[model samples]
Target: MPKSVAGGTKWTYFASSNAQNSRSPEVLFDLLVSCSSEQGFSQVAYGALTDAEPTRRPEYLPAAVTVNFPSAWRERYAERRYNAIDPVVRRTTMQSAPFLWDQLAHKYQLQPGEMRVLNEAKEAGLKHGVTVPLFGPFGQLSVVSFASSFDDVDPEYRLSRLNALAWQSHHTFAEIAPSSEGKCHMKVALSEREKDCLRWVEEGKSSCEIGVILRVSENTVNFHLKNAMRKLETNSRTHCLAKAIRPGLI
Candidate 1:
């Protein structure tokens, strides 16, 4: 065991098992916080694929409170809408790899409110955090984070171990995130045609472009897309991509 996490090892089992068994995003968040607590960390947050036809924010699980960040900071973050300016999440969106806090400091300067949040994060004793981005079937992207305040901790080791944990949890999360599609519940089950259509869309294909490649009419391509959306229960192509890919549909 690494010395930074010596006394906090119990969290390992708790998080892994809970990650394995989570029935919903709420359950997952609940487990994430529990694990963070065991590791002596004061904060943790995560977002995952949700069942939304058009893939709106409401379909995504609202930020569930797992740790106690100052309510004032939370209010300010929401009020000022820092999510648009959040460098951490933006970076997460770009990478398949996990990220650490230090990597962002040099590129993005924190505004006063953002800095206050960062300071709070630091004060909570968080020396480091690991953000794992999980990619699913269509174009689904989800992030799982584990953090700690103990400065003595080695983030590399934690990230390596936690990434394995993240994969396991993602698989489990996929199983539960979609609740309506009996056989296809949790994961998206895409046919070859549907998968092809979605893949083209991800590559920025217009229906006509996709039709040209598939040797079908643009209307045919659109039909496949609509079928895919129906199968994924997504109202729009983008949501379908996000959900299908996350659930491993493609």
Candidate 2:
């Protein structure tokens, strides 16, 4: 489909559903995380899945921008570094449409590895879901997935709303996610590594711990931190970490 064809989908009503005028990426990301519930999803996960599919390598695990996932599920996802096998990740890499997870499951025969991830997610309370594949102007690919307990879902209505939401999210994210990071916009650029480092900081991980997790040297982690501090304009690590997290830079 022509990108604009999807881009032009009307979301005027969706925008007005909330009276918020602040396009602060922080507020927007929080709203995006919960908006799926309005469409009847019990849980939602939004992310900046890397433009390139993650090769099962430690170096790229930190590149994903995920929000609002269940804590336990997120732990398992990271422990396993599931991106290399996540069906949603594969679909977002090529699609700009909102699709059912079931549809994707059927489209590709799942390897045992993929099936394990899906089953764990199901046990984690995500019984049914739709993924909104959002594409930014400069070819960045992100996604917002909505899920719920097993129940009848109105595919047409839900996907229509998700499609519209995907388009809106793409533009909003592009506008705030620094241009240098992938999409050019209103914010200052923070290298993906810097964002990743700060996110680990928020998780209470030390530089050495993060280094082990992300497969970089502690010195490299410190280097990214110093650079993030320079870009964020705060001298102390705590303040810089706070700033990076406030607008969801992680």
Best candidate according to TM-score: 2
List all candidate RMSDs to the true structure. Answer: 12.0, 17.6
lDDT of 1 by residue, 127-223 (tens): 6777777665566566666767677767665554455445444444445545323124444567889888877765546799989988999999999
The TM-score values for the models, in the order shown, are 0.51, 0.56
What stretches of model 1 exceed 4 Å from their correct place? 1-26, 36-42, 49-70, 106-117, 123-127, 179-250
Over 73-185, each residue of candidate 2 has an lDDT whose tens digit, in order, gives 87889888888888777766777456887676688887888888788888987777788765433555566677776567664556655555544554444545445232223
Which one wins on lDDT?
Answer: 2
Off by over 4 Å in 2: 1-23, 51-61, 64-66, 180-250
